[model samples]
Target chain A: MSNKKIGCGCLGCSIPLLTFIILLVIILPLSIFGVMNGAFGSKGIPAPKVELPAEVIFHIGVFPVTNTIITSWITVALLILMALLVTRKPKLIPGRLQSAVEAIIEWMYNFCKDVAGEVKGRKFFPVVTTIFLFVLINALLNLVPGYGTWPITNYAGHEVILLRGANTDINTAAALAVIAFIFIEFWGFKFNGLGYLKKFFTVERAFKGWGKVFHGKLSGFGDVLFGAIDTIVGLLELLLEFVRLLSFTFRLFGNMTGGEILILILFFLLGFAGFGFVQVGYIFEMLVGVVQALIFAGLTLVFATMASEHHGEEEH
Target chain B: MNIFDKLAELGFSWPTLVAQIVNFIVLLVMLYFFAYKPVMKMLDQRAQKIKDSLDETQKIKDQAAVAEQDFKKRLEVASKEGQEVIARAMRSGEEARQRAQQEAKVEAQAVVEKARQEIQHERDEAIGELRQEFADLTIVAAEKVITKSLNKNDHQKLIEQVLAESTTLNKKA
Candidate 1:
């Protein structure tokens, strides 16, 4: 077959092919050298340090601002800017940006509605969507290049990176966990009123059992036993609610830090070989980021729904 | 170990947490006003517009159907009226033709009756003249046969009486 029949046989095809060949030729030796250097420990490149704490970039009054806070601000600015840009003049017949913005919001709205009933979903939508977007954008933006590269000398005369992943910082995670906790409890109280406290306090069952026991009914001992168990269970439930804050904070912080470290280690190990392979870690991190964001947001939604439910009403 | 010290070891600062919380609240508020509310409103508005337009289209379709029915009804009425007019015109034409025929027949019969009367009158006058000529001729023949002069008035009376008797005899036969 003629070249024209076989392929495009044009400069466009040849140019990319030549570029690929050249890149392969260059990359092959470089990869081998990188592998050799990594194996032999030639001290050519130092291993990257894994820092758990976010470096304080500056201070406002007594409050020491960290790099993660800066990143969070950047995330907030980016999100707000995008929101404003897309929704400046919303049209019935939307443009591309408007359509994308609407699709995301609508998807989140429908998700909330699906999980919670319509009335409760409307109440939960803002906080749930905010948490999802905040976590998601913060995680995704952390993967962008130059986040950990820009070093600046602080007022304390210590060198620290200017920006870090917001989720990597314990303080930010803790803040989000605190917010989620507060909102969950708030919604619980709002929906179920003072009866919400009954979820954690089972004095009524025990009180009834005590009253029966005082009336000289021997079978009331069974009720008393069960009531004590119920009270303990309620106490445990209360403890679990507090424990959720710690879990929520650490889950995000651990995953984000581990992802960052994992990518760093991969880059250090493979050196030039990391060119193609490190992308795998990045892809993994991206998936982890999306999953973690979803988990954080989804858990908060589930917890809030559980909290708002009238537990005592179901038994009656 | 102090719990605060332990928390500090893990890089959890109260000020930073508070700042972050404040930041998040700011973000949430901003996003609510800028993104969620407008987008949700726009979506609802679009849905409403679609529903309204669909309803309008259905209404217009229904109106078109009603108009078509009305037009068909009117067309049927007009056609029925046209047929009735045609039938009425035909009836009037038939009556006019019958009336003209009856008048023509009467006129033709009148003309025939007048012609028959005129023919009878002419025949009677001609018979009277023929009878008068015959009388004159008989008189002249009697004068020739006698070959002498006689009273004219007496001969005339005798001839008239003879003629009257012969006419009566003809009538009897």
Candidate 2:
């Protein structure tokens, strides 16, 4: 509540603050090299590298595969198994685990309803719930050891290798974003009929204003020429419709890739020399996963809300 | 991979669209039955049962309260009846005592009156005898005064006095 500290009361603000603290705690000591005892932690090791989740490891169709991929796959399987347990034979008196899960489901249900309204809430619950589960599963996998196994020949040539979060790869984040973006427009069209296409025409009305200018007070030849310029401006507005799709897809892709690259680059700089510095990257990556998930879901809720609004003139 | 991709990239695939559509609908139906419907039903049933239980509890408490009031009312009526009986008994006993006292007072008065009558009768007898003695003395005095002048007229006066005295004695006996 105090204004003296920079913690504004919004839930999102705590995220960056957590990131700051995590980075400070991990990297600050590592940058000083011998600031603390090097015997413990990743300092003595050549590279302070860690593993990723299982599902992403299995989804690895890329070169230079690592144990991190295996971790990502395990994360996905664990997520499904968790869902099965949570859903099967729910009791009136919930077990602690069941109670915790139900509390989360209820929170999402209410949140969706508030942001998207009742009809849209019903439509969006499934997608949002799936997104939440997927993100959580990936986050959990990082804790698992040797997640999904793959044999890679090292520089010394004895096979040994990898694990990682699936989202750390651009392919996974892009896949999720594409799925979300496609669904957003899909739901929009489903709810709004053919009129969903009319979003492109929102800016085209400027041409009508231009036409009126020449017809009414601006009837002179010069006014007609000016009206033509205004009509061209409306045409430019038509061009921007396609740009919305690019913005939607790229914004998500860029943020996720940036977070992943930021982690990799941090580790590359410090390797084993700056062991703790790499953990700062993982902490950042973790926060990024949470943010990306929230933003993806939040956008879905907002778009669904907007698309479902009454679009036409009301009849009295 | 290229040939397959090229075929798809070059032209539209009806089967893919149909399959995706089917998958989406199936997903919706599967999730609706398995997850959504059960959750909603559970919530509703829980709410209903809570309300019904509260209603039942209230009804039972009301019944208990009514029974308690009935028991209290009966106790008060029983106590009131007992007090009334005691008061009536006291009133009856008082009346009986007052009647007995009144009869005794009347009987005592009658006995006293009878004794008074006996005493008056004795007194009258004694007074009668004294009067008779006095009359005898008066007769002897008359005889001494008039011994020579004892004629028919003196004799007649003595005889009438003696007759009057004899009648008064018979009345006293």
Candidate 3:
């Protein structure tokens, strides 16, 4: 036979071909059948239990320490460790780790600058970058092999997973949302001073129209009607501002929890098949992590930009 | 049930929220100091370094171009000066040659003039001698023709007078 034929008449070619046949024709089917028949000391896959509240593992002075809190602390430590490693002795000509770190920070900085103007973007960059790194790392680390599998006994002597994604916890999401809200309002007040309140509590036009009516100008009723509409609109704007806190919190919490549940369910449903197929969900989760991080940071930047601007002034 | 009860059901605890907030704030501060500030400073430093190097290169290039032009200018001046020196040498050679020819001509003319003056002097001396001999022969012939007719002194006086007259006539002719 020619060397160009299927078999190269050498040990190297035959070994790989034989391995492929055994894997695809024999082992793959056998594994699938074994899993289906509950063979090889295998109990059938259990139904995935979806938990909403992060389980409390311990208490510190009446404070419950949940798995999500532990995970967030790990995320914080990991981030700080990376920062220290890359920045310990920064070189003018960067090495790989330094370059990667710089790329991430610079990209986020530029994103903030693009969404907000230079001065405001500079002010907002730290908070935005922090949120992004914290949320993204938590999401990605949740997909590591030991995350949902490492069982520990809580103080109540009940078994629970040691680590969970922080973003899946509503409290962490709310905390982030609360911080974003505070900064947005703070920037608004800082840039526009007390005039920032005029966007929500517009009473000057109504007072002026009433003064005109006292002077007996009948057409002032038009101004009154318009001012009333403006006031309602301003109230709506105010209500939406508060509503942003809820939306931001739920959006992150829901997406992270849903993605985790999705991977868990897919593994349970596919069993032997999931070894290869569940990687799709992992890739999708990674993409979702990145996108969610961007959305969270980008929205905060946009809102901060909007807050810092004067309401009635034309945007440059 | 109230909204507060619903929020509790969703696991919204004040302590966890506070802890997370504090955690985020700490991270923001740490990252700002460690990562953002140093990296930005490095980037700016790199940019400044590149710009300075580029400016230095341009300066060096300009200096090289000026040096080359100066070299070319010096070469041209040297070549022109060389040609001037050669032309001066050739002009001085021609002048020397002409001066030597003029001096030779004047010397040859002087020699020729001196020879002519010497030849004139010799010719005058020979002519005087020949006249003397002729006068001597004519006197002897007259004495023979009138041997006893007159005394010797008288013949000598007469011959002298004749010779004087003939000399005057020859001078006139």
Candidate of highest lDDT:
1
The better-scoring model by TM-score among 2 and 3 is 3
Report clash pairs, candidate 1: none
Candidate 2: segments with Cα more than 4 A from true spot: A1-73, A143-161, A202-287, A314-316, B1-37, B47-173
For candidate 3, lDDT tens digit of each residue in A1-316? 2334554456336777766765676557756875676434344555577878888999999989999999999999999999999888999899999999989988888999888878888899888998899989989998998787688999999989899889889999999999999999999999989888888887667777888999999877888888898899889999999999999999999999899999888777666555556899999999999889888888998999999987764222
Show model 3 residue runs off by greater than 4 Å: A1-6, A9-45, A312-316, B86-173
Candidate 1's docking class is medium
Which consecutive 10 residues in model 2 chain A have the weakest lDDT in total?
A: A51-60
What's the distance in Å from true for residue A3, model 2? 41
Which one wins by DockQ: 2 or 3?
3
Question: Which candidate, 1 or 2, would have the higher lDDT against the true structure?
Answer: 1
Q: What are the candidates' interface root-mean-square deviations?
A: 0.8, 9.6, 0.9
What fraction of the native alpha-carbon contacts across the interface, defined at 8 angstroms, is recovered by model 3? 0.75
Ranking of all candidate structures by their TM-score, best first? 1, 3, 2
Candidate 1 local lDDT, A1-316, one digit each (tens)? 1334546546335777767867888788878887876733436434788777788888888788899999999999999999999988778899998998899889888988899889899889889999999999999998898787677998789998888989989998899999999999999999989888888897677778889889998788888888899899989999999999999999999999889888888878887566778898999999999999889988999999999988865355
Q: What is the TM-score of chain A in candidate 3?
A: 0.90
Error of 1 at A315 (Å): 8.6
Ranking by DockQ: 1, 3, 2
Worst 10 residues of 3 chain A by lDDT: A1-10
